[model samples]
Target: MDKYAIIKIGSTQYKIHEGDTLTVDNQNGKVDAEVLLFSDGKTTILGDPTVKDAHVKIKITGAVRGEKIVVGRFKSKSRYRKGRGYRDTLSELLIEKIELGGKKATEEKSIDEAPKKAVEAKPIKAEKKVSKKEPAKKVVKIKKPVKKGTK
Candidate 1:
């Protein structure tokens, strides 16, 4: 509930907030490009460290250059000393808000489709056939006199 932002500048992700300035390792975006940061793609788990696709508002403070270094290739007595100034393009950002995206979509759909789902008149009652089981009848036995001799 404490308003925070998940911002992605280039391939690096940052968790930032209002007035909280942070530097990204790389800078490959415009000053204000809509970038969505997520704990994961599913849009759940804010502080799960994995983050979601929730787009946050940011104002790129400015792009800064890093330090300098020397990049020279020369022989010992050949006298070759080449120094170069290299500054990395670092972007500073201030996190504004972690937009609540799904809230509106879900709320709108639920409200609009509620009546449609309820009023979709199905059959009032289902007609099912019921068969009765009957018990099997036994045959009656009749006693017969056996012939004593070879009649």
Candidate 2:
């Protein structure tokens, strides 16, 4: 059965399958995107705007920048010319899994993994330490007004 799905990432739509690596606009960290459509060779499902309980798990592999493009501006009969270069920031993502209708397409370790034991932590008691040195006294300053000379 075909395991392809149409998913939206940022402002772009991508047709991806399991283990597909896609480079898209820079995204912060790994994110889950909504699946717009999904097909399994014989059966196909579509979402109303977006599929309910369907999502694509993507892991951001790395960040990349496109090749620099040089832009130049000049006016006829004028010596004024300006040039600048820019690069588009891109992020590499790996399609980890796609779930349709609350069902995972890929088998995960959530169910098979052993349960973690909760460790009981003892409450710490803090004791105030008393120092043998005497506390320093604060000095108060008295301000005296200067007497004005009689005219």
Cα lDDT of model 2 by residue, 64-124, tens digit: 9988999999998989899999999989988877667665443345767889999999999
Model 2 scores what on Cα lDDT?
0.81
TM-score of each: 0.43, 0.65
Report the Cα lDDT for candidate 1: 0.56
RMSD of each: 23.9, 6.5
Q: Highest lDDT: which candidate?
A: 2
Per-residue lDDT for 1-151 in model 1, tens only?
A: 3455555565666566556777765545544333343433353354444334455555567777766655766668878666666667777766544565554221235445644455576777878989987988989999899879875
Lowest-sum lDDT 10-residue window in model 1 = 102-111
**How does residue 97 of candidate 2 score in lDDT?**
75
